[model samples]
Target: MLTTRPERWDRVVDAIIVGSGGAALTAATMAHDGGAEVLVLEKASLIGGTTAVSGGVVWLPGNHHMAEVGISDSREDALAYLRRLTCGHEHDPAVLETFVDTAPEVLSYLEANTPLRMQPVANFPDYFFAYDVPGKKSGGRSCEPLPYAVGDEIPEWRDRLVTRGTLMSLGSNTMLAEDFAEPTEELKAELARREAQDIRTKGAALIAMLFKGLLERGVELLLETPVRELIVVDGSVIGVRAEANGQSIFVAARKGVVLACGGYEWNKEMVRAFIGYEVQPLSPPNNVGDGLVMAMEAGAQLANMTSYFGQPAMFDPEISRDGELVPQFEWGRGAPGSLIVNRTGARFANEAMPYNDFPKAFGAYDATQNEFPNEGPGWMIFDQGVRDSTRILSMIPGRPTPDWVPVANSIRDLAALIGLDADTLEATVATFDENASQGRDPLFHRTELGLMAPGAVRPLNQGPFYAVVIWPGALGTNGGPRLDTNGQVRGYRTPVIDGLYAAGNTAASAYAWAYPGGGATIANGMVFGFRAGRHLAAQPARDI
Candidate 1:
């Protein structure tokens, strides 16, 4: 039998937060800072959840950091982006407006009270729709947390620190393959050295930085503890019943219990029922919608169940265990220098569109052919130039370059490898290559269409061309319990569920169609988490 920690019960916190991802941690920090005793319960042995494994950038438009750098942004522009993206997507306007208006204040609070710092991801464009929007910084607004301060200032969390690529590093930029072009031998050597030294990179570094701050503030984290149900008394949420160390621990919350546990990305039954497809998930394994189930049990109404945020993710079915397939994030099939095609040997939507748009478009493609959603495995094709110029991170074993199988010297050969019609594949490649040569992809209208960079370019004439099968994978499901402006759960015949709140992927997102930025999910979590914490902390103790 596994040795479990002795069961210890406590009911003294001002708030009890489920899931220690960005949302939960942010709320815990806010409640603790507001003089409320906060307890964070995480089902995973590690605390960060999906946030720890993600690209640690948050999209905060009109933020204080933007002003610090002399870039002026307004609420109007932000709202316009929201309107353009959501476009009749069942989002509450009030909540959307609040997210835009109060973004700066949330940034201010974090800078003032926490170790988290912010910086803009320069030159990156908003997925696509905001290309012509005024006052929109090309890359608009994305921020990263600064490195953690070393020493015993924060305890125990050091061991729990999450690192990228299973190592530790500091001040490393989360650049895509394009970002590493012309990587000097010195830089490559340095990266290897860092990898050898076991430095934490990207999201891992950011989570560790935030965890350090939470620890310094005396916040208590209960890992491997799962909240089984919410404690509601007389139409108001009072606390939670959790499974901790093989015992039922009932923790009372004088303020509120914030649910930031992620969506049901890994729940196969829920995904097939709700999303209408079988998709490999890109989020952490623990995101099984425990919070959503608990909230629904307490009468929370859900929204956007038919929709999901999707990405063009690399798929390897053979490596799957217990019906769960691993998803590759760094190797984007539709990044700058590549294009995606369906099994019918026809190019579908713009591969360069945001990941969310890709899967939705794929679903549309499947619908057009009267096939099951996500039925046709997608293909990514690129030239040797792309191979040399881009940093394509693949999992092929013992190869200096990222390995892409199913390659051929001719379209017919490639088609045979990918199981596509020979003539159709030849015609498709001919048209694509013609358009690429002339800087015009008429079919998909890929923006900024151009030839592969000089160094990264390899002629398609090379024998043995490459292809990889892809599927509609997701970071997480977007649909969940509907939340009001103040992060309160909504129900029929009720204005809002008092003392019940949600944040992160558990709450329905404002961006239902287009992804606003790379770190928008984390931003939503932090923003709503802060709002829910303050709103609950300000409530009278009797509201509990």
Candidate 2:
């Protein structure tokens, strides 16, 4: 934190927003609408953060759009569901209440202010829908931005998004939560039309719509400008010292600086220090906890430091970003003919569990053995039947196994190739096959056979088996500076940091370890961001 205020500021704005994801942009829009002069600074040359590459679904519990999909949600139901999910977890129940109360309103505001049109993801179930959980909707609580003809509105921003392609295995052709079933001729033609028009769907559409709103409001968004530190005056954050063109630029915030600079998943030091485990991040390389560091320097209290949105990630040599191999997030471990086994060739989890919940099994400790028995280097073992019917990483059905994936004609040979105990592996596969043939998973009691589609329980007896190493990965880290209901950053010594605020992955997640639905991350970040922006806009201008 910068203690001394600069005599002159390079630029002045009522609110200086850091990061350019859903959270940051939402705050910017809200602040701008609330009569504050907002300036958004992005560290990456691109505009969107992980939000751009995500599924772009927004979890709105009592959203108006739910009715369109024949789903009903009440505030009480929403609260009950969240409360049950977050029970015994390190989270603020009040924050969850606040989010439940504020989210629908924020969604309404966003729809009114931005060019975003939302629709329920068709038949998309909440992560815990199958569980006996109250307030869990089988579908419709999570909605996504409709396809937007972005090129028609902002042609200049067409090529500037971080990645038009999503982190999801379902390629760019599919919209939010749309399945990977073979497309009909009409659907293919529609997709072709969208491609020709440079129309974006899902996360891309969400960001483009928000960006369009910012552009319309004349909000000054500077790309490649990273805020280095906060300029504190009398224990309150008043401005920021940012870097641009290899020079330090001091920018004054009359109201406050909102840190929405995403999570620390990419920061190896911070990840090792805080998360205390290996986390393969699915987000952009720029999300290195800049806001968290600044908040820590400002004496901000941290919360939920060890929690993250976890997923089972598979390393695919063909996929990379920023010259680094980007692991493909795999949520289909429970697909028929597939199972993940530890180094001992033992299956350890109900592989059909939610992606966020699945990695918890990876960290399961064997107290007797005094080690993490399930902590990977685990292998996702599958058969040619799966390869011929389902998609795994870049491997499409009917396509030859990618050389990167280890394959063998027998389960014992596959185990040998992947350094697993051949006898144990063969026995595990045999038992699984027998149980699967009986249409039962007595050991794990897995009810769901697939993630996106309903899969039949099939025996993995086909030859040419394949294996890929599975590791703990994440969409992003969801822990950092704690924020109050108003989205004001809480200080260690003070009740609140008067002017400093945080939202998104930069702030501790309100949901804690409970990931309610598909777009919980974006939804949680956006709600607080809206709150922060509204609160920041209402603040009186401070003196330099």
Put down candidate 2 lDDT per residue, 162-195, tens digits, no spaces: 4375566666846855555567897888888988
Which ten contiguous residues of candidate 1 have the minimum total lDDT? 450-459
Clashing pairs in 2: none
Q: lDDT (CA) for every model shown?
A: 0.70, 0.86
Instruction: Name the lDDT of candidate 2.
Output: 0.86
136: Cα error in model 2, Å:
0.9
Return the TM-score for candidate 2, rounded to 2 decimals: 0.96
Q: Each prediction's Cα RMSD?
A: 5.0, 1.9
Clashes of each: 13, 0
Q: Estimate each model's TM-score.
A: 0.86, 0.96
lDDT of 1 at 304: 79
Angstrom error of the Cα, residue 282, model 2: value is: 0.7
